[model samples]
Target: MDLDQLRTFDRIVREQSFTKAAAYLNITQATASMRIRALEQLLGVTLFQRGRTVTLTDQGMTFLPFARRIIGTVQEGREALRRVERGRIAIASLRSLVSPLITEPLLRFQQHYPGVDVVVNEGRQAQIVAMLHERDVEMGILCWPNIDPLLVDLVPLVIMRERVPLVVAPEIAARLPARPSIEEVLALVPRVISLRWWQAEPETAAALVRLAKTSVELPTGPARRLAIKGEGLGFFVNSAVADDIEAGRLVEIAPPDFEALHRDTAMVVRSLAALDRDMLADFIAEIARECAKVGIILDNRLASLGDKVA
Candidate 1:
């Protein structure tokens, strides 16, 4: 019922673990459990099936959406109060997208709307969604998948997509007998991946695994280095590594049959009832236009998986 309870609940659902949620929210485990218990008692439904591994029950799944919105509402109410006195807008995104795609545009956006402070949240997809659910940010650029329906809308913004090369460190590449096939490279290379791309992109997903994800996780920045060092082949968004490719640091391992792969980009919006809402709408439109003017192709439906990676 209280904002604290709602936030605690949201974190619990995000992490799917009581202790992890407590650690995230900076509360004791007992306090986190107590809040969930209190919330369940208040609502008359067990939210989570408590055990060695916390799992959402049917009721827990049902309660999750409502809890997110309630927490979102509480945060929005506070922000609305702040906005009435001083303007602010927040955006969360993958760090990659924010680099060249958004940096200058944001500077220009701020110039026009000097009163509005743009707070940017950059991290993996789940973190972005968690921030959105907690009302920590008003807009988000995130890799796609498992986004909850409670979000007002997820605009398919297709910033860019390129084929992921199986890039081993050049030494690793040199170890190969000759050119390699995609399957052969995956089997041979030490894999690297961001939590986001590994989790979000279907093309990356298919390459790495299938069936609830055989889950080969990797560190964030190693793919590029791994390719240079020959540690492994990892996925890179094409735009991200063009310079490296031209510089010959990483080269796409070509398979005779290899042609295409896929990934998606999206913008998450706050639910409709939220405030500063109109400004956000305008900002989204302006960004779409600006991206187009720069040849980003705002109507980005399908981008080729060229000889690039990210």
Candidate 2:
């Protein structure tokens, strides 16, 4: 019936256990049970089917969306008040983009707004989206073509597209002929260290897999390292390995028959009205400037938004 009970119900649905939800909320199991019972009584319907594992009843399923909306609205109200009282900005970003895309822009933002407090959380795409929905962060930085229904209500403040190049160590590049075909490169070094950090097309991903005699899945950091060590060829966003390529640590290989690949990263927000317009504009400008330094170009109409905010 109350926010606490609704929160408890939502947490239980997420955690799939009353005991776990209680622990997460830092409340006693008995108290959690009492709140749920109170809520069920108020609603005149059994919400959850009690069992070894928590399963939502038909009525609970019907109420879940409403519960989430109420929670989100309350959270938004709290966030708006907090923003007015204190200069606080929070964002979630993909781990791979943190170093290349987020760090420099954040430093520039701090220089401009020294009194403002900034919090950055790093996670995968899905986790970042969940954080946005839960109102845990005001904005998120992630790869584009998300296709998640949850993003329908959000706005993309900035979108940057960067080329994805095939790279390998200097020594590995030396062993290959000029303008080598993908098959020719794979013949010399059959292993391909793959990182799916970008939202590549399904057919493109499958094609890359098929080309590699030994396809190894790795996180961004490790995949870059392996490619630097000449263990395998790597497909990476240009910004990620730009310094390495410039320093002669990694060399980009252009296969004549291979398709040109690009990945788009976006800065998304729940609503523009909840943000400090001037501050957000400055932050966006800083990000665009930094990305351009690494050859990542703004691919969307956010430049006009930035101008309007300015």
Candidate 3:
């Protein structure tokens, strides 16, 4: 009948114990029992059957999904209220696109909304989305295509920069005495720096089909530095490595046409509709204005690809 009862049911189902649920909700065990009793009385059905081990009744089982959703919706609403009270919001991002997309908009958002503090939580896409869904962060900038349909709102941020040549040390290139090609550099080298493609679809291009020679799965931050140290050549997003290439720490050579390296990004919102938070609409408008620099161009070639996939 009330959000608290829904919360109690949801916690009881998840934790499988009244005591545990009470501890989680920061309420006493009796208060939890009373709430559930009130809920069962209002519903005119037994929710959970109590024994040494608790189990949901058939009616409770039927109600579980709705109960979880209601509790979750309530939790999301609370998070937005907390955000408004705190005058702060958090943003999440994938490691690769963190700097190029998240940093710039965040700085601009801070300048424009000086009273609101911005927190950027950078991690891989999965971790970022999990944080957003958990209400650990208010927003996430991550690749598009898959997000929790219920908990989050996804908006297209950018099309991303064009791919770049992945290279190894020019010195290594000279010493190898092999043809100066990204392929040769990769094949002949003892170890080519490996980007943690945890979410990356493996490049199945004929050239890239060969497994990495000596792979190291370092976190995104460290992977960049290790590549620069000449320990191994790393393949990275052009946006992440562009400045470094100019700095001469790593050479950008003709890298393979990696087959499955598609990266897209979006902003994740926890409860835009329920919380009456209309700011993301304004934020999306700003993104559209920025992406208009080179308006959407539809080429016959890409259209054909779409058709084939379609």
- 166-278: candidate 2 lDDT, tens digit per residue: 89889989988989988888887758877876654546656877878888989888888889888888678887888899999999999978777888878887777644556
Candidate 3's error at 196, in angstroms?
3.0
Provide the TM-score for each candidate, comma-separated. 0.73, 0.82, 0.62
Q: lDDT winner among the candidates?
A: 2
Better of 1 and 3 by lDDT: 1
Ordered list by TM-score, greatest first: 2, 1, 3
Q: What is the C-alpha lDDT of each candidate?
A: 0.63, 0.82, 0.61
Enumerate residue pairs that collide in model 3.
Answer: 143-264
- Which portions of model 1 miss their true places by more than 4 Å? 40-48, 55-66, 145-163, 166-216, 270-310
Which candidate leads in TM-score? 2
User: Which residue runs does candidate 3 get wrong by more than 4 Å?
Assistant: 1-64, 83-86, 147-164, 175-183, 197-200, 205-210, 255-262, 268-310
Off by over 4 Å in 2: 1-57, 275-277, 295-300, 306-308
Write candidate 3's Cα lDDT for 105-155 as tens digits. 566666667776667677776667656655667556565555444344553
Error of 2 at 174 (Å): 1.3
TM for candidate 1 is 0.73
